[model samples]
Target: MGDVLRRRRPSRAVAPLRRDPRASGRFQRSHRRLDLRQGCVGRRAALLRWALAEMQRAFLGVDCGTQSTKVVLRDPATAAVIAVGRAPHELIERDDGTREQDPAWWIDALRGAVRDAVRGERFDIGGIGVAGQQHGLVCLDRGDRPVRAAKLWNDTTTARECADLTRKLGGDRRVLELTGNLLLPGYTAPKIAWLASHEPEAYARTVRMCLPHDYLNLWLTGEFLTEAGDASGTAYFDVRARRWCEAVLAAIDATRDWTRALPRLAPPLSVVGMLRREAAESLGLEAGIPVSAGGGDNMCAAIGCDLVVEGPAAVSLGTSGTVFAYRAEPAVDPLGEAAAFCDSTGGWLPLAATLNCTSATEWVRELFAMDHAEVDAAMASGGAAGLAFLPYLSGERTPNRPEAAGVFVGVRPSHGRDAIVRAVVEGVTFGLAYALDALRRAGVAPTEVTLIGGGSASDAWAQLCADVFDLPVARPAIVEAAASGAARQAQWAVEQTRPSLAPVTSRRFEPRPRRDLREAADRMAALREMAGANRL
Candidate 1:
């Protein structure tokens, strides 16, 4: 990247290197080979004085989500992703509100993804970082083996345990004071309590408890460590204090020492450990390479979208919907409407999340026996008119109503398939709008909202975000914000420098706020408040 590394012109007497067609796009021994022997060292140095240039280096970013594991090879020099690989995980679901995945499945997927990405590429990988879905509990035995399947964020089996823990710690407001968020079923703390009661044997075997990303870090670096951003979602971590709250942990289980069981918290911007030999061999990486302490998916997305400062908010529309904004200090909502989370940048990230978005649309599509194209086309039609949907086919997180179900208001006998689809999409968008309002109430006034994730691909969804929130919704050129953020963190940790690549919107959706949107938001809230558990 400098003059010293630049190749010089060849002299008239010197012949250029020859290429072999049969080399399969690679260098052959005769065409270009360097012998590192002592005798050939001088000759090798002289031969390279006028021909080849330095190869660009890259970093690996791994995003381990609920449904899949995605890996990206990003070149920091160009701020571009060179290659990507993805592998899916099978979600294990039972009738009793249990959803899980084998921890081994994640490891296999991670290794396979690396192999898939680097199969034919030739570049130096400088470092590695991982961004994982928050709140999933991955328990390990004394031998570092998984004790059981990891309980996912949507698993509702721990609702009773969560309630019991909340009761022990005091009510909702008191719990918020202790943890900066509610003790919901989706959080890690409740899962631990669930294990202690329902699966006592497994609880006894779980010597170490870690979030999904922390487990990946352990496998990569042989270090049991976690960062503040991911740890904040555990429902036992104090966002303001930036540490685990002992009182909350005691409420979960007074008999156990959680400080010893939980992974040690690593500094947000630091490199927790180096890549170990075994993991390196498995992932085709160099041993002892630095691995940064990447944050949770939302925190990493903040970095990817350049939301490190307190300006624009980020909205991720994947299986779920989440809106997060950065702040200099913790924005603890007294009502627990927005989670007072910590970002990886040592700032606060006040986040409002919904448990439904694309998943809600998917449910409607399945019920109607329609495909993606059909749903997209239908959403392009006129709005649902007076109809409004709650879109809570599954329970919701934002309203703190785990018993809530889908509700449709003002549906007429003449409402057709197109209107139904419009209502579903609109309902999902409105839910996020309500969530964004929570952030605003907590003192985050974002200039705009950056849309990312799978749902951002839909023009209909992007336009709805703009219309619903009454703010410009921008979509970045990069699709994998979480993975991109992980790589950037790793790059910064190693080089102590980052490129001047701010987020640029490839497409911008300006606001055309509908009067009906306000009415719909009001109706949804009225339903949630009046009859969260009843159809009446």
Candidate 2:
């Protein structure tokens, strides 16, 4: 499996994600085509586009995350965030590892959030982009309406389906060769298989299966389309070749031609379609506005943080945590531990994900009846010694254990809510640290990591990331990196030029000298091993 990508490991050529097209234009001379940042005229022309972007049109980005739909409006030329609004989601969480949400909820949330962001001012909207949590299975009928609630990325109910698919496809090595990654229960292909097995009636009625963001695009433009970045997570995409894996589709259903129902793979920085009049009215935007080929949340965050040229890795501490680094070439984890995904900027994103992060913290907060302030205080109270947290509230992902649940180890009699919360934070950080080690083995070496997502809002958590990853951690001033990345992608699709954007960071946290949590990391690893093996 490693040999497939090892042949191309040592060389990569692509320009970095740009803050100023004048300084550096997005360039790629690789064998891969569809470079979003190709035709650059000159500094004067680029600067003129920048000025026009700010003055002529307002770009919109909609991010439908696990817990909310956040809308961000930006002046593309100036890269200044104009307005932001958010609306919460009601997840259908079950003890049986079932995580779902009604597809209608996303559009309704988008409607509310977009209306809030625009504040009914009706600015000249140029383009819109969508960044959504990936690997969700959204089944649709012949009329392009959802057949059932969308299964989310954190859902772990499809372990049996994942195993059956792998087994039928000649096991792990062959599966990896087909998909460029292992079949995790969190992925969409497994969910589709599960739907066929468990809900045969719904599956029979389902004429198509689209990802969460793809579904949003369908509602907006009445077209079925997906991009390489988000498609890579579906377990039916050839990440290396940037196409659909026919073998995986056959394994899912030999009877049906699943590829026919799959959305067209749109190129990066290209408009998937224009906004329909109904969607425009609902979103309070102008009709016929272009919609960019937006990507998965992590992919969008990579652009938002400017991680295109592989300077440093990115740690997105969202509902589920992810540690990823942008690579010019494919970053293949030979052991199949990390994901070999595609980036939004026509590059590769080698990534490792944990199923829990803020989800774990929020659970602990509710368990202890504490507010966000108290959670921050608990993060600051890290005096608890010999304690470890194993965050598996939504089951494990990187370790590929779907049945495991979260647990607190080494709790002493003196351990209070504050101490427990501290351990929880530490445990979540340790999980991401484990992922970072996997990336390191995959050749993703970096001196620092950029922080994004809701977890980055806490000062104590930023320090914890620096301490855990043992690298300098910086949080960009752009609070909603995914949404901002979406808007920026939309801007690029409209103008076909890189926006002059830079990371506006408020602070950078440096790891303390020899903070030394090796023992704790090992302890958590041991607990994870035991818990995953059902021994803890």
Candidate 3:
């Protein structure tokens, strides 16, 4: 873990520390009183040091993602990334449709990422924020330790529980009215319902239930609190009102008292608490640094891309693909295809998520024993070649088919490996296009699209997204939007002002009209219908 952190160092040196013009006025006014006190030479020196440190402080942002924990250190004023580090954690997958991770692994990964990010650097950290994968259920007992493995968002063992909750709530539409979302197997409420029915002993022992980011926040600040963005994904939260809905909780058999199990709600940009002594010591940082109430990964990514204002939508193509847009008012989809979520900036986020993305491309790359560059070359030359594929390697979410499996249609012997790989890539892009259409149906019309996540690193993939979505796609200079957004939240918490740094677009891909894509779209529609009819 330590080795993971030490592997990457910033290519450029940070600018020398200087007095911040923004803080000079306040510092001068406060210093006048320090000089007037009698026998205060030591106190004056300490105060001066503290004031100077504040002028040159750097902010730390930790992103506890599904595969790894990433840390980024940046200048709050300029938003220039000074250093970065990451550490990977293992994911437990089961044949019985279970996905779980130990909370302890997250803590260890965060420690490594922080240690590596700040190695040989001595800038005072002004504030810290964390963003994590949403919808994960972290259960704690009276001792504040996890009673069982944390259930992740991809875990699908709660299908029966989802059906039961929907029935108890009267129907899917009624559930959507109460919670702004339909009962889904990936949601926290269904997971809790499953736990109560299957593992009654653990449910009885549970004293608290929180998301992954909330657990990390508790370790840092010793306060159990969550903000609107992540809380809205819990399925028990009322998105329109921005609070927990007792009716939704009752539907899951968690009564009014279950609200106590949830963390206190905090404003997204507010400081939840100062870093605790133990956490500071473990990460080699000073105690009392302000920690902001961070948000879910999607919310933070929106911030990282400067999607606080409308007109630009963000499409993240990671293990899962999501299309999200900022909205001034809650945009509830009556059919429940789009999730009505809250943004970290006190706005609404209407998003549609698909279960598969780069995971499909990765599968093809591994099958051919090729590196990314090799795959890119093959895709550039192979084209679609009339081959079609459904990239539902791990089932699906947007179309609501949990039992569906991957399918390859229109394949011929002459198509070979390269053509199949290209088909896989196109299939994933088509899946994202379906999500984009859902957002459009919900009345989100973005002037431009921001493509992000691990897949955005490939120019070929970015072009494919632009061509398929039929919109100009821009990739920001910084690829780690989630961590960058978390840092911006930290800056906002410490300064009491929104960070003014605009995301710099390093490259933009314009949509190109292709006759072949039109035919491919038809094939995709037909294939989707076939899969729906033959769902396993």
For model 3, the stretches where C-alpha displacement exceeds 4 angstroms are: 1-56, 254-256
Better of 1 and 2 by TM-score: 1
Candidate 2 on 256-278: residue-level lDDT in tens?
97667899999988998988888
Residue 161, model 3: lDDT of 90
How much does candidate 1 score in TM-score?
Answer: 0.89
How big is the positional error of residue 16 in model 1, measured in Å on the Cα after superposition? 25
lDDT of 3 by residue, 54-134 (tens): 445688888999999999987876788888988888899987778899998999899888877877566667889899999
Deviation (Å) of 62 in candidate 1: 0.8
Clashing pairs in 1: none
What would the TM-score be for candidate 3 when compared with the true structure? 0.91
Query: Using Cα atoms with residue i matched to residue i, what is each candidate's TM-score against the true structure?
Result: 0.89, 0.88, 0.91
**What TM-score does candidate 2 get on C-alpha atoms?**
0.88
Candidates in order have lDDT scores of 0.83, 0.84, 0.85
> Candidate 2 at residue 239, lDDT?
92
Candidates ranked by TM-score: 3, 1, 2
How badly does each model clash, as a count of residue pairs?
0, 1, 0
* Pairs clashing within candidate 3: none
Model 2 worst lDDT run, 10 consecutive residues: 8-17
